[model samples]
Target chain A: MNDDDILEQAARWRSEGKGVALATVVSTWGSSPRPAGSHLAVDQDGAMIGSVSGGCIEGAVVLEAQEAIKSGNPRLLEFGVSDEDAWAVGLACGGRVQVYVEPIE
Target chain B: MKGALLDRLLAERAAKRPAALVTSLNGGGQSLVTAEETHGDLALPLNVVAAARTALRSDRSGIVEADHSRFFIRVYNPPLRIAVVGAVHIAQALAPMAALAGYEVTVIDPRQAFATESRFPGVRLVTEWPDEALGALRPDRRTAVVTLTHDPKLDDPALEVALRSDAFYIGALGSTRTQAKRLHRLQELGFNQEQLGRIHGPIGLKLGGRAPAEIAIAILAEATQVLHQGEAAEAEAAGAL
Candidate 1:
């Protein structure tokens, strides 16, 4: 929601020793609901920070963010249609996006 | 550098600065498996949640005030950062998406006309030429540089800077032919094959279309895969993360 709310929560998690992964929506196309610069924080417990698209994509992102944290691997995750993504995440509107996923250290 | 980055991000977040945190990945002395957050260390008292009234009483140095119920354990050491060169239309779409995915975004462009504060309201906009910008911008490991400027003068110099730096994601925007031409120039300028390997030309996912916004999405989407799911096949890479 608010920036401080997120900071407070992220700080609390860090202080309390909770593993957290930060996910960001780096790019989007075609009537995507969320704007770019949206931030989502996925902790080990699956708590989320900012939103990427809308309700459509966050759940999926949380799963990936958690895995990233668990695996200690950072990845660029994408959603929607492209030549390569003809059968992937496939958004409802055929909108495409860039998601950079990394485990928070 | 890591500590300062953390401090800056935490302080900015704490102060509601709304500024983006951009980390240089695998830069000199940067590690992939063990890359540290240039920012993200914001600790506050956990006891505050238990006794809301006493939050102010706690001794806070590196500590801020957070709910005592909240816990802090480093989950991911260093998050990735996306550095945008040329805050153009594509950047408008790209910056916010990068932020949404949790990547700190920094926009560098010499064009004040295009790289103005209004264009990118929430992100960081650096009104400097790419050469000077990358020096101060510091393209490190885990950091990505995308050049959207159609002009080679703008993107080329930046590519040189980005290639030389430790930035993992170095991309230049143009057609395949344009990219080849640009590469030829880069070669003439003394960029070897190894150095050229680092640059991603004809930037963005090959979406087979040409809308600015759509192109922006494609570029960032491809960048996402490279930055996030570099190993996965390009076809299966697009998904929420």
Candidate 2:
């Protein structure tokens, strides 16, 4: 889905009384899978749509997004190839990506 | 991001208006900036709004720093459109290719027999006269208009409308001699040399292919080249300015 579709889904989730968090790739250092404005929308029930770092960090980001939805606070998470577990999840492309996760209010 | 602002953003997109959504990372504020007006209460600075408009024109989304605040400007332009003004064999090949390349393809031909749905599946077909269809479509900078019909009554009228519009690429399929004759006729109609120069007569990259599909490939390739390189040239011009 495009950014608009993700945002629209977030709006729908909010109206439906379900907690929602929007994760956006705010910046990338190198060889990022998606561009800076890519988004991922996660609901309170773990239902998710869209993508941020292709498949490398989506699970981690989704977990963090659920936490943000609960705490009602935004979180900025960063992932890079130099991380210890980078190779385990296939992010060893010598790149770093910063994602911002914020709850929809 | 969940009230009037989101509503307006969706409305603008639905109406096919060019817009940008600016989100401030530090403050978590959002603003919708359109060519006609700015919506929402993000309290964005003038410089940020200016930068957002520039991003809209470039049809790209990225982060911009203004006054120590980093804002993501998400551009929302209408989909790229390509109107092929002849539902011939070439149009049959080009329409599907253009659609596959993520362009909204429209095949226009007044002849009902040629503009059938079976020939061009899942493509918008217009059976009106070329000029009438083009006028209604109003090809803009995001549009590329190509005239494939060799008939003067059909191709010339469409070319006239395309030249006057802001379409990024205007191409006509013809030989050198045919193009010269067409240019002479257009010149007599009072089009300046520079204006006529916008038409890529003998259209498409010279791939030396005679098959209809091969010709279509060349045309689409040339159109893509012009669309991207033309934007680069305009960006250079703007930077120089």
Candidate 3:
């Protein structure tokens, strides 16, 4: 989905009284799969609408987003390929990404 | 973004208006910026606004820094539109190819027989006069206007509209002598040399192909070159600034 679609979904979720959070790729250091400004919208139930790091790190980001929605606080999450378990988390492309997750409030 | 601001942004996107969504990564503020105005309480620094405007103009989304803060500018631009001012055989071939390349193609011709849905399936067909059709289309910076009609009556009016608008690429399919005559006519109509220079007369790169499909391919290739190079030129200008 495009950014507009994800944002629209977030708006719908908010209007429906469900908690929502948005995760956006703010920066990339190496061969990141997606570019900056890529977005992923998550509801309280962990349903997502878009992607931040393609398949890599989305699961982690979604988990963080759900937590942010519950806590009403934003979090900045970073994932780098140099991490010991990078491949296990799907960052095998040798890139680093910074994602900012914030609640819809 | 929520409520009215998000609704307004979605409406802008639906209207095909070029805009930018500026998000403050540190402060968690968001705003929508268009050519006309900025909406929402996105108290961005001046430098960040400048950078966001640049990104919006180039139809690119990225991050920028200003006043010790980082902001992401997400650009929203309408799809590239191509107005081919002839429903000739070449239009039949070009429309689908251009659509495959992600351009919204419109084939215009006053001749209803040639501009039928049977001839060009899944392409926007405008059967009005060239001038009227082009005027209503309002070709902008992301639009490419190509005149495939050899008839001076049909082609000239379309050329006039394309020349006056912000269309990025203006091409006319014709031979050398035909192009010369067209140029002379346009000059007589008060178009300056620089304005007339925008026309890629005898349009399309010479690909040594005589078939209609080959000609369509050549036009698409030339149009793509102009479109991408125009973006590069804008990027260079922004970097220099």
Candidate 4:
């Protein structure tokens, strides 16, 4: 989504007394679908802003952000197509991303 | 107060400035306790719709805080610039792509016929000689330059100027042989092997397509890669740290 859209959503969340969190696609490796710097904002209610991956990783990232927003903690989440423990989330292009999450309430 | 900060960010972005909207996901969100209204809280708290009413009216920074637990919404302004030194077919394709990719594109060419408004729609076309044109273009960290002229006389001086700057990517289009000759000349001009290595010679990734549009896509992709990778040497330095 555009920066304005994201900012608008963020403002809306903060005003409503709801917890908010921002997730950024800080870095991506090999054959990634989404560009780095793509952003998504998540509220305590599972609402989202922007998009990181097409649809593959948003749910996972939203879940991560929700926890942070609720707990007022931060985290770095990773999703990739690595083998062994990669059965849950497997990207077709073997893309991996480092997500920086910050809680905002 | 939080609303005012958010509105500034939106305005900057709408104005086509490279503004970054930083949200707090899992990091400690910066608290702007002083950002609160000194008057008092609303009996019915001002919703965002209400907040946006005078969002741009105030100079309040955009951060909301209850305590140490707070969220930051910072807008970072980064300029978007692209200097394209050519009026060739590839440049025609590349110019709009730069615009679509959010760059303030400047097309510098010695040929007025080749570099015109009709030819490059929405591009800032400067029909001037290369060396002089390159001098006008600012090469910042966010800027990128592409030399599609494939002419040593036009490309060399501009490329030299670009090489000395902090532009994220410097690409020159042509086959490997032509690229080799161009680099040889750059070397004669006193650029070392390491500096010469910085150029994305034979520009664009090996998309193996002859179409100008396809070549443009490869160049965009390569540019995006360079922008995010943060430089291999810098990455290595970070690793060492």
Clashing residue pairs in all predictions, respectively, total 59, 0, 0, 13
Q: Assign candidate 1 its CAPRI class.
A: incorrect
- lDDT per residue, candidate 3, A1-105, as tens digits? 456678789889988999988888878888999987788999999998989876989898888998998888888888897776666788988899888888887
- RMSD of candidate 1 to the true fold? 15.2
In angstroms and one decimal each, the interface RMSD of every candidate reads: 12.1, 2.7, 2.9, 7.3
Question: Per-residue alpha-carbon lDDT of model 3 for B1-241, expressed as tens digits?
Answer: 5457778877997798888888887887888888877888888677777777898777667788788887878787777899999999999999989987768899999999899999998789999999999999999999999999899999999999999999999999999999999999999999999999999979998898979999999999999999989987887788622
Which ranges in model 2 have alpha carbons more than 4 Å from their true place? A1-20, A40-60, A83-88, B175-181, B205-217, B234-241
User: In terms of TM-score, which candidate is stronger, 1 or 2?
Assistant: 2
Measured against the true structure, the TM-scores of the candidates, in listed sequence, are 0.51, 0.83, 0.78, 0.60
Q: For candidate 4, give the lDDT of residue B126.
A: 87
Error at B139, model 3, angstroms: 2.0
Which stretches of model 1 miss by more than 4 angstroms? Answer: A1-7, A10-105, B1-74, B229-241
- Candidate 2 lDDT by residue in tens digits, B1-241: 4456767777887787888888888887788999978877688899888878777776657788889988888788877899999999999999988887768899999999999999988889999999999999999999999999999999999999999999999999999999999999999999999999999989999999989999999999998999888766765654411
Q: Chain A alone, TM-score for each of the models?
A: 0.82, 0.92, 0.94, 0.89
Model 4 agreement with the true structure over B1-241: per-residue lDDT tens digits: 2345445555555664433233333343322112233121222123322332222222122433332422333323444578999888988888888777767789899878888888887778887788778777768777898999877888888899999888889999888999999989899999999999989978988888889999999998899888757644443443311
Model 4 lDDT, residue A100, Cα: 73
- Please report the candidate that would top lDDT against the real structure: 3
Local distance difference test values of all predictions, in order:
0.63, 0.86, 0.87, 0.69
lDDT of 4 by residue, A36-103 (tens): 55678888899887887877778878888989877777786777887433346545567887677767
Better of 2 and 4 by DockQ: 2
Using Cα atoms, each model's DockQ against the true complex is 0.06, 0.43, 0.41, 0.16
Which RMSD does model 3 reach against the true structure?
A: 3.9
